[model samples]
Target: MSGKRSIFEEVGETTPRREAPQGGMIDKGRGRARSAIRLWLMVLFALVALMIAVGGLTRLTDSGLSITEWKPLTGALPPLTTADWEAEFALYQAIPEFQVQNSWMQLEDFKAIYWWEWGHRQLGRVIGLVWAVGFLAFLALRKIPAGWTGRLVFIGALGGVQGAVGWWMVSSGLTGTMTDVASYRLATHLGLAFVILGFIAWYIFLLGREERELMQARRGKEAKLFGLATGWLHFAFLQILIGALVAGIDAGRSYTDWPLMGGQVLPPSIWLADLGWRNFFENPGLVQFIHRITGYLLLAFGIMVWMRGRRSANSATGAAFTAAFVALCGQVVLGIATVLYGAPWQVAIVHQVLAVLLWVLILRARFLSLYPLPQSIRRA
Candidate 1:
């Protein structure tokens, strides 16, 4: 009996029994919560995109300069009485946009533009309330996973900053020197919004891989591929910034011809202004030409990245690459059409929407590449 017991003990020592708990109901519950948060974040991102599109329409319609005041709180409510409309119109009449550009504009004309500006402000308010409520709910329920609380806080802070930046952009036009907000400030405001969107997408990816089994399965070569995908996602963001600059300067309004501007591969003179560097941003013609050249360069880079992704063994990567390729082509076409159509409000809005969608796809690809679906989930 002692000999048999010794043999059993030896066998037990040789085959190590893992005491670590297999993630069960608790993990599933956590996963469900994480998934819910991810879906919520995605919805929030879509709302943000809608806001951006509407803002672009506001700019294109010259409606940005229609409302001269920035009442952060009460401004959410639009004019409900004739007295209110008169007051709003009176305030707009004081600005240079009214004095110089729209002096002949009537109260009815003012209302046409006022509604767009008001709608934009109201959207900002809605976004703020949604973010605050969602964040608080997560904290109250202890649904946010460990290490993610800090990130959520950062996102909240960004939301605040974005509100401030929107006001800053509006303030630029209020001073009367320029009919529109400074293009540089506009780019900064848009760029920060994109950053917030990208961060939320990344957080979702992290939450989806909450299980140890999923994490282990995703380790190694798959992880490295995800890192590469993230790099491409960042590249797409920079391109969007450049696109914003193009919009801010009214750069797209200048050059209409595709593949050539005024029958030349390049603008006849790269820099026409006395100040060489200033020409890039201030000169609409030069700015448009530069934007076009940059677009082509970005297309080339995106194609290369997509091709490399196709060579990867991961099907997720292959799918991402294909989507990127298709999106880039569609975006390029929309961009050219926008320029040729003279930046019409409807076309311009669609162009901006497509850009946002492309950004979302790039972000999704990066997330999937970083964390491949676990074999069990993939099969399911």
Candidate 2:
């Protein structure tokens, strides 16, 4: 028989509680926390989409250079009083864009363009604030999942750099003979925007499922299919950049015919510009020609990828690529229509939105190729 004689004696040996793992190894129990982060990222993703739409509208309306200053803090407030409006208009008037192109505009006309630019910049500010608050809160609370801190931080950093790049793009038209920003600069700005969007989308996909699920799904990875889809993604991105260049120089408005430029296979004097190299950037004929060729190539490559994706054992993965291919065809049709219609603001904006949609779809297909979802087979 056992006897507990002393009241002050310890009853048993105490054990220390195990602490949760950190530094890139997430605790599997943190599913709820991961979901929260994904939701936050989704919010940011939507805002960025809006920002891109507004940006497209701003360019179409020729309002990008309306705001002559980059006040990251104070610029949030629009011109309130008449005097403020006049001051802002005066600043714009000092710029080459106004002096050369919009010289006929009055204060009221300036106000219309100013509001477009102001709204675009304001949306950007909101995005930055949202990122800052969310990131800091998660960091302070130590709720960020392992290996995600740096990825999230990188997005914020890109945003800050993008702000600087925006100013840089604007400054290009403020002086010199340029009535608009350089086409290459515009492409850089837009390219970075898509890059940020792509990262956010990829992160959302990764976080949608549990870590264990992703790891398990990786076992049946379609290595060849993933490689092909990745190549397709890169090609699509390149096409987007080419499209940006087209928009920047108003190249789409140069020819109003599909499958032909000025009723010919290729427009005359494609390389007759003073600077042979500059023709690729400044010559509407050459730029649009390049864009068209690239589009055809992208379509062909996408079809190849889709064919491979159709063989995916996972139905969901197969369906994703199918959807992506459908979107691509629709986008091509929209693009052709836009060109034929002289790239009107309404049609052009729709084209841009479709491009974004297509991009996300391709990314989804590529992702599944990397991490396929498991499906249970039913017994006969």
Candidate 3:
């Protein structure tokens, strides 16, 4: 003003201004949405665990053979009236399991078992619907983060394939050759379900990891611990598969004693059958013995993992090790009880439930090890 310069020119000459970076709001919103997706995935994983447990109950109850038809849509709705009940029961009557093994069973008795099978199938339908709705919602809202959509889609496809596999398993028991599903098919189906659950759990872990802030603290040790945890996860999954084989062929029912079968450390003539390989998986006594041996091996591995973790008490890996140790002990006891109890429905179901829980714990340890939280964040 003293020099009589224009106001605008005076301001421009006094200071240069720079525009701040834009799009920060969008980035932050995207991050929040991704976090939400991660939490949702964890919820989905919990539901899967429940489904697996329920399926185990169904198997233990001998209710798998109750529902003889594959009616995806119509079967979703249970019998609403007496006529409907009769109609469903008539369909079951035609099945080999009913005609051959359970011909004396009355309609009322059939209904009791039918409800269990119906509940299992209905749960499957619910899971399918829930997955579909969640997926569509995520897609429509653009909530799923980049680099994850394809994996989720693949998981959804697997769910569909699992339905077909379920039917295929049921079909094996409907004909003249077998009264129950093929042990191989049963193992395949159970193994695939576990795989699907594992994938979901891992994806959730990845999502949570991205939201964490990076720290300057040393991570080399943590990284190695994570690798070890991942190994345990893989080993636990393999053990579960072997357990499934034991369940599929009723192997657990055949062997009641622990540490030894028929008063021998190694049951003599375990492979007495004509075909050697067939004996391992097919013969009931051999299969049971192998499963027992595998259990011992799994316990040994778990103990080693726990001990190594204990040696490094300051690390998160130690906590994971402790958890695996506890779970392994619980699982062993449950296995023994299940065997000693003649695989009673209740105890057997609990054993299966524990196996699934051990699997979840192993997965959680691996995730935590891979993406450790900074001490500052932990404290906060």
Candidate 4:
């Protein structure tokens, strides 16, 4: 039996209170490498962005078909000796791109284009290696957070598929009269690239904070706003694919006019009787027309999403959507400039890079909508 103690006396010794657990409350159950994983993803993000820029340059310079062969392991090392280069050049000379389009290219000229394609492939290999090493190390050490292993592996699987699709795209031009990869194939390749980038970006956002915080924040998610952003993202993706078609066929330079095509509501030769529906992808005027109209529609929808985003109680979420809309506006300006200037490599690459920026921005906005972060009433 225990004697009763005064209200504030040493009753603590008589009856023990359950103490809270030690260690970090926020990261209690999460893995220790959350920050490390985030850093790795950011590195991949930069590499992929660089890959896109280099790829755009390769296309603009008409250098994509230079290598004329796919050698995943052997191709990693570019030609080291003159004899090796000569053998490589011989292979390129046999392709339709060299025969019909670049027949005048000497060995030195071939070297220029070869370097671009080789560099693109090498960068891809480096990305694959980096991903493999980081992922395996995390998984082996059990450093990956619970429920994240499959998501990480999914990224690697997509990377492998991208490699195979890339080869398929290259093979299309090797035997045919086509000087460039088929336009639809190019669109597919580009669409997949953006998809990969989106996944990396979404994962990065999720990893920025601890798992507990994300769950807490999810309770306050703005559902309607999220729905709007989802629609906006899908619309933007469609526009991107259409834009790829325009680039694939050099349609951007076909008209070089805005608000009208060939000084008319529609391009004079907008339809190809023989190609029929294929005209949408193969015909330059029709493709650009669709790209422009899609741009207008995307902008309009973005504005609607942004307006709804304004109602979010969370300041950070609203700000993210505002940033996305600003990017969309700037991208429109760049698009107009790209057409006005005939899609020069300088302006065109910038346009392409801006598209990447806008894409990330939209994704960030979407993430914030799904995980509304509470903010201080006063500035921090």
Candidate 5:
């Protein structure tokens, strides 16, 4: 035999070297992009949370009506000169809030409140810009997942609506004998903020898992528990809105005593002679009474949900509900304490912050219920 070696002696010719299954390439890219988006959303989430806190402070300090004009784009720039400051103050002076409630304020005092409103609006602009930049960067890079483009865009839409809603709430106070924005309008604004926050948080939870994982997890979803958790979530949301209504009318300060309001289970008057349905919104007594009853109902509902959560085979899911229940308990305590203390800014802000915490915890619990993670045998 001639000593000619085969050229393919050292090479592997198995199956003609398939091109690594091109179908999964897109999915891999999508997974990575989804992760990046999730991180960006977390940043937005934190910013929204901070915005809520700042808004609470603005409300508590009676600084909400400091700016009389909407001026969304142009108002971004604050007063840069004494003349500018005077112009801004003059605008505020024309508002009913200044004419009726804050009449004793001078330019310096006006500046104090003006800064709060400006900072609140400025933070909103920053949130909007962050969302836009991140969403556009992903789109430019073609990194957004197949179904996520609309969701990302929706966040921006909601933010735009929120901005308009903010202006509407502000405009409510600028006319006629109104010293503050209507309580219903204030509730609407805060309700939308929490709604946006909820959606962002839920998207984050969904993106935390891979598509395959989420699909597989769906097979084992705890349907009944999910339903219960969902109900609890709705209940909690209602309570938050009621709390907003309470804050809008300074009702928390009205009922300083918790177990009893005004030395009785019910306050003396819940209605005024001329006003009929308006009293429910404008009357501090009725609003606070409604808030108190809703809080109690919320606690009972939380306990029920917690009992159901205890039965979850998945330890992580069970623990999430437990945490939510615990937060609810803490929030109730904070509410009572805030009331006992006449809703001072410090204590009241803490109360509002606890409401935020409770909200996120409930959302987390519900998400976990929807997509329960597998538990380790040892941990189980």
Candidate 6:
């Protein structure tokens, strides 16, 4: 045994040195799949965003109902031969969209719209296949993180529902005198898409961080900021649905003026529909008005959220909110421009894409509110 040294003696003589320990088994495996899972989710995110943009283009080109049947398995393969093209065109010709509105279109014209709708459906199939393959591969490898299995499965389930809802929206315009899908159904379809997008985004945010860091950050969560962000997110989502309503019935094209619709505080034709509620969904004037007013309110609330977010102790959190608020401002301006230009396809698609950017920004801010990144104390 080593002898104990006197107080003034060389203290290093009696001190024992030990080896530095390595990570324990518990820490070794936890969140091992986070990076891989995050990469998979990122791919899904891009595909879904592209899907939404393509969907908007499909609607803008009046091609949504061109493919009248929901043959999920068979629909993935686009028409190849001349006979196959004719068969598909015949099915479309039987729909109200073709008979009532595009009777003048030749087989060639029919093929134009057919390709857009086909591409849109084909993208959806690709997204589903990606989700299935990634999830199954992770599960098979036992690499999926604990507490995340259900969340991953939920994304797949929403994708399935989206496919069903897409068909439902398309089916609406197939019968009777409807030259387009019901406005409300279109809104529902778009709303579900946003919801799915939201979930994927939130998951991506969570997975961007380590479980240990996330747990530690939770102690410093800005509750008020999180709450405000949550409110703003919901309000923004509602506005998106309202915007979809406007898009569904081409309301943005009804008014070529901004701040005022048809040179009035409210369009003179705001309540022209036979039923009051129908006016909300079917009246281009009323629908556009609601979309405008809600957009204004959404901006107002977003500003308040930003003001609060700017005061967060964490600089990263503040930066996120600032970006979101800036996008919100840009979106409002774009909305005005879309109205002024009568919702031209180019301007309208830009506006749609901006809305998506703003959505992700708000989600990022909300995530930071719940899990703020540590910042240096050098700032005053």
Number of the predicted model whose TM-score against the real structure is largest: 4
Q: Arrange candidates by TM-score, highest first: which order? A: 4, 5, 6, 2, 1, 3
1-380 per-residue lDDT for model 5 (tens digits): 46865876675565376566544444686887888999999999999999999999999989999988878789899999999999999989998888888889999999999999999999999999999999999999999888889999999999999999999998898899989888888899999999999999999998998877787787778899999999998998888888888999998888788699999898877767777888888888889998999999999999999999977888888899999999999999988998899999999898888888899999998988888886521253
Candidate 3: pairs in clash: none
- In order, what lDDT does every prediction score? 0.78, 0.91, 0.77, 0.88, 0.89, 0.90
Mind giving the per-residue lDDT tens digits that candidate 1 earns over 130-186? Answer: 888888999999898767788888988998899899889878887746777878788
Please write out the lDDT profile of model 4 over residues 1-380, one tens digit for every residue: 26855677765566878898874476765555998888988988888888888888888888888988789998898899999999999999999888898899999999999999999889989889989999999888888887789989998898899888888988888996888988888889888889989999999999998777789889888889999999999998999899889999999999988777789998998898999989988999899999999999999999999999876778888888999999999999999999999999899999899999999999998998898785622254
TM-score of 2: 0.92
Error of 5 at 345 (Å): 0.8
How high is each candidate's TM-score?
A: 0.88, 0.92, 0.87, 0.94, 0.93, 0.93
Candidate 3: where is the Cα deviation over 4 Å?
1-27, 211-223, 272-276, 312-314, 376-380
Count clashes in each candidate, considering only residues at least 3 apart in sequence or on different chains.
0, 0, 0, 0, 0, 0
The model with the greater TM-score, 1 or 6, is 6
**Which residue runs does candidate 4 get wrong by more than 4 Å?**
1-17, 21-26, 29-31, 376-380
Candidates arranged by lDDT, highest first: 2, 6, 5, 4, 1, 3
Q: How accurate is candidate 1 locally (lDDT)?
A: 0.78
- Looking at model 3, which ten-residue stretch has the lowest summed lDDT? 211-220
Q: What is the lDDT of residue 105 in candidate 3?
A: 91
Poorest lDDT segment (10 consecutive residues) of candidate 1: 371-380
lDDT (10s digit) by residue, model 6, range 249-313: 99999988978888999899989747777898899888999999999899889888999998888
lDDT of 3 by residue, 1-380 (tens): 58786756646564878888764343465777777777777777877788788877777766787888899999988899999899988988888778877889998998988998888888888778878888899999988776678998888888889889888887888878566777777777788889889889778766664432322233434676667777888777777877777777788877677767767877665776586787866777888887787788888888877776666534565576688689889999988888887788788888888887788778876665555545523321
Name the runs in model 5 displaced over 4 angstroms. Answer: 1-26, 376-380
Model 4 Cα shift for residue 248 (angstroms): 0.5
